[model samples]
Target: MDTLRIQRMNMGSGLQNASGTDKAQPVGDLGVWHVPQYMPGYPTAATIWPRVVIIQCEGDVCPGYEVTPELGRGEYLFFLPTRK
Candidate 1:
């Protein structure tokens, strides 16, 4: 027998919404998948609150969109992960 759990994260509110292309609209289709987390050498804890996904679009108008003068090319996404 196998146990299954369903969890949904809405990326259309708070800080996420403030800086997203589709503030009023949600991105992608809603679906669920089975994922597993593994610990290598140490014990750790995980939480289920905030999750992020990357979104990228290309066009002539916004060819290689640059957010900052120093930063070249714009790779937009729902969440930016921190380096561990």
Candidate 2:
């Protein structure tokens, strides 16, 4: 998906009245460069760019969703992946 398409998403919010299993559509992958994980001040050549995937969540998986990433959510609830 394109940048505009990603921006148009709901930013990870659970769907009300959602039943059955949530379906996760693989939107795409994002490559972040030198993201400051710890030490929330500034990245002084110590931060590492981690690998993560972006998924367009559907149903209940939208809100408070979590996959098996090595580093978990980046201090945010949104921008997470869902199960297939």
Candidate 3:
């Protein structure tokens, strides 16, 4: 199976939720990177460029979501590969 990847990125500070709550779920002393939902025509477990917000730290793997790059810090891409 193809695996999704994610790299920690510094957003200059902590991230917040829509309800004005701080996403400070420390993963090894790091805050959470709250990803945006509602990317039409794709699985909830994946993300694409320009629509996804880049943030720091390898956050907790969301139930139906996944990160990309599987490496160092920067903008990460999330996508699901088709099986043949």
TM-score of each: 0.16, 0.24, 0.18
| Candidate 2 lDDT, 13-70, residue by residue in tens | 2333343333334333542111111222333554454345455544334323223444
Error of 2 at 3 (Å): 9.3
How far off is residue 82 in model 3, in Å? 37
- Estimate the TM-score for candidate 2: 0.24
- Candidate 3, 1-74: lDDT as tens digits: 11222322332222322222233222222222233332223344433333233333333222233333333233
Best-to-worst ranking by TM-score: 2, 3, 1
Per-model C-alpha lDDT, please? 0.24, 0.33, 0.29
Runs of candidate 1 with Cα error greater than 4 angstroms are 1-28, 31-43, 59-84
Pick the winner on lDDT between candidates 1 and 3. 3
- On a 0 to 100 scale, what is the lDDT of residue 1 in model 2? 23
Tell me the deviation in Å of residue 69 in model 3. Answer: 15
Deviation of model 2 at 68, angstroms? 15
Candidate 2, position 12, lDDT: 29
Candidate 1 matches the true fold with a TM-score of 0.16
Candidate 3 — which pairs collide? 5-67, 5-68, 5-69, 6-68, 6-70, 9-56
Compared with the true structure, the alpha-carbon lDDT of candidate 3 equals: 0.29
Q: 32-83, model 1: which lDDT tens digit per residue?
A: 2122211123333443233343223232111011123242222222322122
The 10-residue segment of model 2 with minimum total lDDT is: 31-40
